[model samples]
Target: MNDYTGFPAAARHLAAMIRCPSVTPDTAGTLDYLEKVLAPLGFNCQRVTFSEAGTADVDNLYARLGSGSPHLMFAGHTDVVPAGEEAAWALPPFGAEVKDGVMYGRGAVDMKGGIACFIAAVEAYLEKHGKPDGSVSFLITGDEEGPSVNGTDKLLQWAAGKGERWDASIVGEPSNPEAIGDMIKNGRRGSLSGRITVHGVQGHSAYPHLADNPVRGLMDLLDALLATPFDEETDHFQPTNMEVTTVDVGNPAVNVIPADATAGFNIRFNDTWDGDSLKAEILSRLEKGAKASRIRHGKDAPVNYSVDWVGRVSPVFLTRETELVGKLSAAIADVTGRTPELSTGGGTSDARFIKDYCPVVEFGLIGQTMHQVDERIALSDLDTLTAVYLRFLEGWFSGH
Candidate 1:
């Protein structure tokens, strides 16, 4: 039997990447460091940069080893959210400092650790079984924490244009809530964000009869939106939820009624509906509520408002592919001695974009400290996750 000592520790690679501070929308030498690491592992690396009109340009890395059927692609993001204040953390966020068997850094668990472990596993596999029986690729992006306009979604298209076909994929997105093997995201809830604007005439607050008060219209519209439940529950998902994120008038004067009022909301939904169906449902509710949106007590006319869908709409998806789900579950069980739950409870991820091409699941390190003030991950857990990934790679390629 091959032992775990065949390759260097995963933490070494993780620390190297953490020191780069690859903040969202900025390469910041992260791609450079990753390419240098991957090239030595026999991967042909490509750095693809994508740009949208308003969003900042993002650089992504795609690397592949071998070219054959049953290609297994590992996807993740190298960019991390800002670390707030360096003085507030026990160790400097970009220092990658180790203390008492733990490593502290911004992307420690959210997840440069997952990336490191997967790479180490691949190295261990090569040291044990020679070149992989199938192909392996890395789809690392730098725009996951930003607007996500030009990261994995574009890299996938760029790769597809170059004739890359993937059989299955695993996104390392810190799927585990508490423990490394506790959860695997077989699917994700869809996300729909929209803005509701109510236009009214500006006037003096004392002369309420002459001018419409947009604030009243805004409250009524938002109430109608929140009054009803989107859905009770789905077979594999939680109930659909809507949260009103912000309501703004941007008016400072207390005596003047703002001419316009706007409210923003985001909905996390399930496979019982798609983007179109969910959007229609929301609009239907808004229209029905608009009838009661009266600025004046005697006014019976419905509110004049519009709904604008923001950015791209992610459709809810569930992976019913038995081969992909079964083998991944079995591999996690074999390594962790605990069966992983197939869950679809998190926010939207690049997996939504990946699902359009091939079946993708998510598994990674525990994320208790992700994006927190003093983010860190245990070194011992890092070793254990490396073993888990190594087992999965072997089992996946074994044609089971």
Candidate 2:
């Protein structure tokens, strides 16, 4: 058992984990390193590899301690996005360099740091209290930064098949934008993506009735979707907004009308809507616009089109019923002297999947630099987060 009191050791462990370069499908021994640290704490660890027919395989880990109900799971991802322009970093992105009072690395703030602190806190708690009265488990995946095809979603199913159940979960994503104690994510907005393709007859641009312009139809359909706001501010969420991310005609000659036009979009919506209802609404708007435009364009204009929903439909969720959120919030206030605002305003995370199984919330270090050029987290924040986790464990299991 290494010294849990030494925060330096925990930071060093995090640095070493970052150096593994475990980017998505290529774990590169990251899980092996984690097992080395966790096995000593009496965790029954297993590495589960999952694969979809057309997609690459992904490696994930499920480690549990204790064997009873009220199981608390800590979830996170060890994989990080590719470090672009590594030379621009003051320290190597994978160097895990600690300079001054902060640690610099690719996964420092996005994650990995949170995992390190939680492991250390749990180790300290076990050293003091022996085995916990309730179970503690870690649900870590390597595909979160990638396609998310074979990650927590599958691992949760695997654990459940083995008769594993969770009372609550905490995703160790960096939730606080300013400081560790400033925010706690009690919910997340749902996400939906879509693409629209408009088909038209190709012809010379100068010809009056020779061709139909698909780009015009696409522009009108896009206008219809964006013209009307999806919803005003809801109680637990912000107003839903959609953006056109890409528009492609693929025509090289300026004088020729493209045969087809394509546009891609995404929506971040609140709990006021679900995937089905939202999809219907979008389709209705597009259909209304397409029909009207086609009628107006008549036989000479090109207006044939199709719309497809792309990617997963992220469902909105809130964790108000769970004691984990309250306990962790109180613990944050106790340790940092700041009351965290329970919020759900952020991009989607793996919490979207975990929410279906157990009440889940997200809290970790400040996230100002996550996925940015030079990611870093202050050493003081690590200590504060560890203390918060320790207090939360005591308060939660003690039934406080």
Candidate 3:
């Protein structure tokens, strides 16, 4: 096998990737390095860049080793969130410094490390068994943490237009909370965020009768949003819930009533609902709250409120690909000697997009310190995770 076929090689590659400082929406250096690594492994590497008017242009890498069926696409991002106050880190965030078996870096577990391990697994598999009977590819995006526009979804579309078809996929998102093999994300909840804006009259607070207080309306709207539970529980997902992130009137004075109020909320929903259904339900509650709140004040004027969905609403999904999930679970158990739970408990991931193309699951290193000032992963975990991936790669291809 080549030097990049084990934990040591994987660690070396990971450190090189970390040193690139490929923060989200910026990946020129990282893509170059990846092409260098994949080119030797017989991959036809393509450096893909995508852009939208308002979002940052992102660089991504798509590398494939073969051109046949049972194609397995390994998807991940090289981008790391900004390492806030690099000086606050115990080790340089981009240094990829190793101390006493732990590698400290910005993308250690959140997860350039996962990508590195997958590369190592593929390298070993190739060295041991020659070429796979089918195919293998990497869809590495650079905007997983940014305004996720111009990233995985776009890159997938680009690849699809080129006639790429994936039988199954694995997203290298750090799915475990404590250990590398404790969990596997077979699905993810959908995300919906929006602004609830209530229009009101501006006047002195002392003249309450003359000015409508939109704060009251905002409260009622929020109450309706929170009053009824979206669901109790599902077979594979947790209860759907919403949280009000902000309630703002932008009023600077205590004696004045604002002209408008806005409340922002985000919902993490399950397969029981989709984007349109969830939106309809939220609007219904908002309308009900507006009407009920209007009656509380005994007013003739309609409650003036508008709801605007924000950004892109992610639809909920579950992967029922039995072989994909079952074999991956068996691989984890084979390597770690523990049965991993198939879960759908995470917030959201690019897996949400990959789900539309092929059945995808998430399994990677432990994610305890992801996005923190001193994000790091244990050196031992590098070996363990690579083993899991190695096992999965062999099992998946052989079983297929």
Candidate 4:
């Protein structure tokens, strides 16, 4: 293997990337910077811009170095969440400042650092092995931190139309909560968000027979939804949970009952359930509770109610194949001298979209500071992650 003496160059490149205030749909010049770095590496880079009926146009990039089967893909996002309260930060959110051996920036751990390390590692590998044995590509999008309407989902379809296929894919999301090698995300719990708006007749608190109280109906529905445990423990996942995030009536007057009551909730389910089944289960529980609950002013009249669901459905998925998960885990141990946990915890990521195309997994720097104030990552950890990616590449291509 060719030795990479360009660790400083890689660090500088990452700093440049961090300097771009590419937050969500408005990726100032992040993609341009990426193209500049990849072009010299012999990657055929192309920008795919997409626009929806009402949303702003989004730009995504698909860069590939080689062609053929057994293709490997490294996917990530360049956009980051907004940096709140700049004055509260030790360094500017986009400064990419390195102090006392740690790089501080908005996207440092959440991901821009991973992209830099991988690109550098790939450059070093090509210096030694020439072109890779098969193929290697990058699928980067700017919409990961936004609505995600015109990002990886559309980019994947465009790539497939151009006859692109992958054997395995790795998303460089920071999956480790503690150290570089402490975790590897083999799967993620499916996320489903719903809003239960209970509609009822409005009434005065004193006039028992004049109005209806929607809050009581909403409470009953919430109780029914949470009454039965989704599951104690599935084979590969924890019990599914539903948390009531918000309940709003907007009733300022104490005596007036609100016409409508809304309760929003989200469920992180495991492999045992899918979108359709979970929806049915939720509706069933709500129906049963709504029938049993009697919202009465005195001892006579009860209120009638209805419920509605909101937002997109996310499916739960798990990848246990030995090739993708096993190989990456072994690589982590080899490089970091720690047995990484194969976890299914955490919220959804771009891996959710990639899983449909190929067996996908995630491993990168520790995410303890991701999306937090003064986000940062250690310089030594960057070197360790580069070595880990290099080791995985060598081992995976060697069929070991």
In order, candidate lDDTs are: 0.88, 0.87, 0.89, 0.84
Where does the lowest 10-residue lDDT sum fall in candidate 1? 1-10
Clashes of each: 0, 0, 0, 1
Model 4: per-residue Cα lDDT over 1-400, one tens digit each: 1122454655766788888998888778988998998989989999999989877789999999888767999999999999999999998899888788888899998789888878877877887778877888999999888877889889999999999999999999998888888988888888888888777678888884666777887887889899899987687788898899999998899988888888889999998789899889887787788777766535343335555565567677788677987778888889889998888888888888888999999988889999998999888888888888888888777782
Off by over 4 Å in 4: 1-7, 206-208, 297-303
For candidate 4, give the lDDT of residue 293. 78
By lDDT, highest first, what's the ranking?
3, 1, 2, 4
RMSD of each: 3.2, 2.6, 2.7, 3.3
TM-score of 3: 0.95
RMSD of 4: 3.3
**Model 2, residue 380: what's the lDDT?**
82
Q: What is the lDDT of residue 339 in candidate 3?
A: 88
**Candidate 1: where are CA atoms >4 Å away?**
1-8
lDDT of 2 by residue, 1-400 (tens): 1222545555767877888887776888888998998999999999999999877899999999999877999999999988889989988888887777788889898799889889878987898888888899999999999888899899999999999999999888999988879999999989999999999888888883777788888988998899999999888899998989999999889999888999999999987799999999998898888876752255644357898899899898888885687789889989999999989898989998998898999998888988888898888888888888888988888892
For candidate 2, list the clashing residue pairs, or say none. none
lDDT of 3 at 189: 89
lDDT over C-alpha atoms for residue 359 of model 3: 94
TM-score of each: 0.96, 0.95, 0.95, 0.94
**Which has the higher TM-score value, candidate number 1 or candidate number 4?**
1
